[model samples]
Target: DGPLARLRDRNQLDRADKARNFALAQAGEKYRECFFRAGLDPLRTLDPSQEVKSAFSPNGLWRCESQIENLQKFRAAREAIPEDFREPLAAIVLEDREIVDVGREIGAYKDAKMAGAVALFILRRGLTALARHYRLISPTGAV
Candidate 1:
């Protein structure tokens, strides 16, 4: 990898440049700032453009359900968790987990800014953890 390597790096960076553009009407500056303050970089990659929002979101409350359930299995009784704490995990979650496979996943999508940025950010950062968490509840790519 010589100067040619720099060219390769450029090719890779180009996609992320495109990905940032994909974040949409809603995933605006506030979401970006929130994520950034929380430690996830908004411009990590291109958007996935999945265009799918679930009633049970992946961020906070969804996590709470599984976390609470796991606790029950670990102990005879599971303590009731606060709904507030369970919310989307949001930027707070980023501080706990860093990017895992940034080069491939985060560097690869094309979608809404907030969702895509968060997806790439989460995939790059919390993917392994998310995968591990997913494994406990469902299959690997369920989320």
Candidate 2:
């Protein structure tokens, strides 16, 4: 694969793995929030799409998506609620938000978790941006 293609594959893999990770994390966060209402330090962990990443299954996010597909029951629920109610969508938006944040944060921080679009985007914008900078400074100049 070309560098971009490899990056895309890894990032897509990471996104898929992260979908699973974020689902479980948010679920645990939800359970934990029930008691303390979301403290400062959220948990962090690696992705789980590799051959031997972990023994435990990573299916919670898929399950969560399946569970949430029942929102058809609320097709009219939005009309019933008052205008002051905060939430607008029936689904969690973290995925897209993180995707967009990837472009933004990577442009700024150069290596931050917030960059989460295509796998290549993550490679350039998230963990590898600093390395990219150094590589650019080397003989290649980002060829």
Candidate 3:
């Protein structure tokens, strides 16, 4: 059997012995557990054929894919909003503006909660419009 298969067997044995104590609920914890279960080998590659010293590791590939997905989501979000509203929302996200500050900038709402609600409503509407534009959703709002 391969090293990975052996490791998997060992992990399963350990888990059986531990009665699920090794299991984690959170995603980050689960990833860490996977690494630990793999015996914490720095030189190990998911693809055994790849060199241990390869610049593009499995983690790097996963990160690259995650970044692309995030960029796509950002683009979709930007395209959803009006041109004028873009700058303000960008400032809120990038500059870490406070709820009160956002409220002040967005006018007509005295309450911070109300302002936040309004912003959320706008964001939802924009996303829905974008969904319609992409034809992922129908006019009756069936996705």
Best candidate, TM-score: 3
- lDDT by residue (34-136, candidate 3, tens digit) is 3334332334334222323335455444344453454455455456556655544433333335434565567688788787656544433443454454454
Write model 1 residue lDDT over 46-89, tens digit each, in one string. Answer: 11122213432454332344434433332211011122322222
TM-score per model over all chains: 0.17, 0.17, 0.34
**Lowest-scoring 10 consecutive residues by lDDT in candidate 1?**
74-83
Worst 10 residues of 3 by lDDT: 19-28
For model 2, residues 98-134, the per-residue Cα lDDT tens digits are 3333445434544444433332333322222222222
Please, what's the RMSD in Å of model 3? 17.8
Instruction: State residue 48's C-alpha deviation in candidate 3, in Å.
Output: 41
CA lDDT of 53 in candidate 1? 34
Clashing pairs in 2: 7-120, 11-119, 102-115
Tell me the whole-model lDDT of each prediction, alpha carbons only. 0.29, 0.29, 0.41
